[model samples]
Target: MRIVVCVKQVPGTHDAKIDPETKRIIREGIKVVINPFDTYAIEAAVQIKEEIGGEVIVLSMGPSRAITVLREGITVGADRGILLSDRAFGGSDTWATSYALSRAIETIGDVDLVICGKQAIDGDTAQVGPGIAAHLSWPQATYVMDIADINSGSLTARRMHEDGWDLCAVKLPAVITVVKDINQPRVPTLKGRLAAEKQEIPIWKAADIGADPERLGLNGSPTRVVKTNPPQGRMKKSVVLDGPVEQSVRRLVQELRQRSLV
Candidate 1:
């Protein structure tokens, strides 16, 4: 089995600044880390590979510095890493981003499965994984909490839902977005880190992945951020509801009513 795990580099801090002009996060000068969710995806892929004896390849699309996350995946267990980076891929929305990633997967060829995190913290849209599935015209199971079974032809996964999870069986070459509940990520050993540091990850440009020029970058992005505003600060006022249980309940309700928060 040749499993591909998709990872992303995201701003490490919650206080990431937004570019007023572009209405996008200003990533420059800020510390970047692997998306927390992607780590679970990596762990899932690694476990799958270890269980059945196959190779796991980590893939990402971002600036050159994004290579760090790819190497990080390698340190955990992935056999190799590939990066998709170029000026053309700049400012790509989820749609365009998934398209480019799908193209890269096609270039890799003969892939058995693709796994990704449920969402990226910075965006939180949770659309890219399904978008990739759509672009590839393959079956997809999102919010996967576990892999129940696997083989060369198909795999069974437990898809998480609001109430609970249900088993989903899909054919080979499918895509799945894993939730953190899937597994705990393994720490990179010193030896693994050294090997990852020495590994040369190939960076693929738009042309290398055969991505359509018209379907990349800002021009190809169907969605645009018209404006952005920071979340309004919460009220700092506090109320102490003391006395008997009924009194406290009544007081709380009164306070809530006064604040129009009931």
Candidate 2:
């Protein structure tokens, strides 16, 4: 049960600006924290490892500064960390991003399962995990609410949907993206923090992972943004109900019926 968990560092504030030219979030020099959702994936991986007895390795892709989140992962429970960083990976979209990640996993070689958050808060596309599965030609279960069981060769989890959840099972070397509902993340203990301080994380370059140059960064991405803008704000209205008790209730009912809110 060698579980690999993918985590990310996201802008800590809502004031994060976007690059107009590339249509991507501007991340340099910003205060960042681990993506909230990825914490659940980390917790899930740790729990699975605790149950089955194996190592939980955390991985991330970003600039050198993104190592903060990987260190955080180690402080919680992961055994080690790996970073995919290089100027060559700049401006990559979900497709290109997943390509590099899958290649890095391939370089690592004997991974049994890959886990990730349902989505990154900054991007919110929820595409990278599935894209990595596709690039690796592995089975994937997205929006997972819980891992029912996992052993040497196969795993089972509850997949979230609009109406309900489904019990999904897949073979080893599969990818799964988990939602925050899966579990509460454990705080980093004194020993864990101390261990994190001594760990030497390995950083991988594009060539180190055998990633094709033609499939990285902006040039490798097929999707293009014609324009980027914030969504228009919605106006709010207030109403007051003042009358005899019966009259007020009747008026409210009528208003609700008229607005089709009932």
Candidate 3:
């Protein structure tokens, strides 16, 4: 089984700049961390590999510095890493981003399964995984809480939803996006850390992946960001509780009821 996990480098701070033309985050020269949710995807892939004896390869699409997140995945048990980076990939919306990723996966050859986080904190779009599935024409299950079984030809997992969750089975060579509730991520061992430090990742350009230039970046993206405004500040309301605890609780409940908070 060859499991490819797609990870991302997202801004660490909430203060992010957007390209008004593309409606995408300007990731250049900003402090970044591994997309927090991607860690779970990495963990899930690593765990699956360990359980069944396979390789976990981490993939990412970003600038050169984004390779850091790939290396981080290697330290936590990914076998190797690949980066999809090129000037043409700049300012890609989720659709374009997912298309590039699907092409990268195709370049990697035989992959039994693809895993990713449900969403990136920076974008909060939650569309890339499903988008990749669409581009690849493979089955997809999103918001997966736990994978119950995996075999040579298929996989079964519990998919989470608004009301509840249901077990779903899909054929191999499928895509799935995981939520944070899946598993606890393991820390990188000293040996794994050393290996990650020395790993030389190969960077693939759009041409390298045989991706169409017309569908590579901002030009391929149909969505545009006309304007972006910072979120308005929320007003703080202070409620003072007086007298006994029970009285305070009652008063708070009454206040909440009045405000339709309950």
Each model's lDDT: 0.93, 0.92, 0.93
**Of the pair 1 and 3, which is ahead by lDDT?**
1
| Cα-based lDDT at residue 74, candidate 1 | 93
Full-model lDDT, candidate 3: 0.93
Q: Note each model's CA RMSD in angstroms.
A: 2.0, 2.2, 1.9
Name the runs in model 2 displaced over 4 angstroms: 236-262
Candidate no. 2 TM-score: 0.91
Badly placed stretches (over 4 Å) of model 1 are 240-250, 257-262
TM-score of 3: 0.92
How big is the positional error of residue 144 in model 3, measured in Å on the Cα after superposition?
1.2
TM-score of each: 0.94, 0.91, 0.92
The sequence of per-residue lDDT tens digits that candidate 3 reaches over residues 1-262 is 9999999999986658876665567787788999999999999999999899999999999999999999999999999999999999987888899999999999998998999999999889999999999999999999999999999899999999999999999998899999999999998899998999999999999999999988978888878777788798777767678789999999989988998999
Worst 10 residues of 2 by lDDT: 233-242
Q: Largest TM-score belongs to which candidate?
A: 1
lDDT of 1 by residue, 1-262 (tens): 9999999999986658899999998877789999999999999999988899899999999999999999999999999999999999989999999999999999999999999999999999999999999999999999999899999999999999999889989998899999989999998899999999999999999999998999998978999999998788887677777789999999889988997998
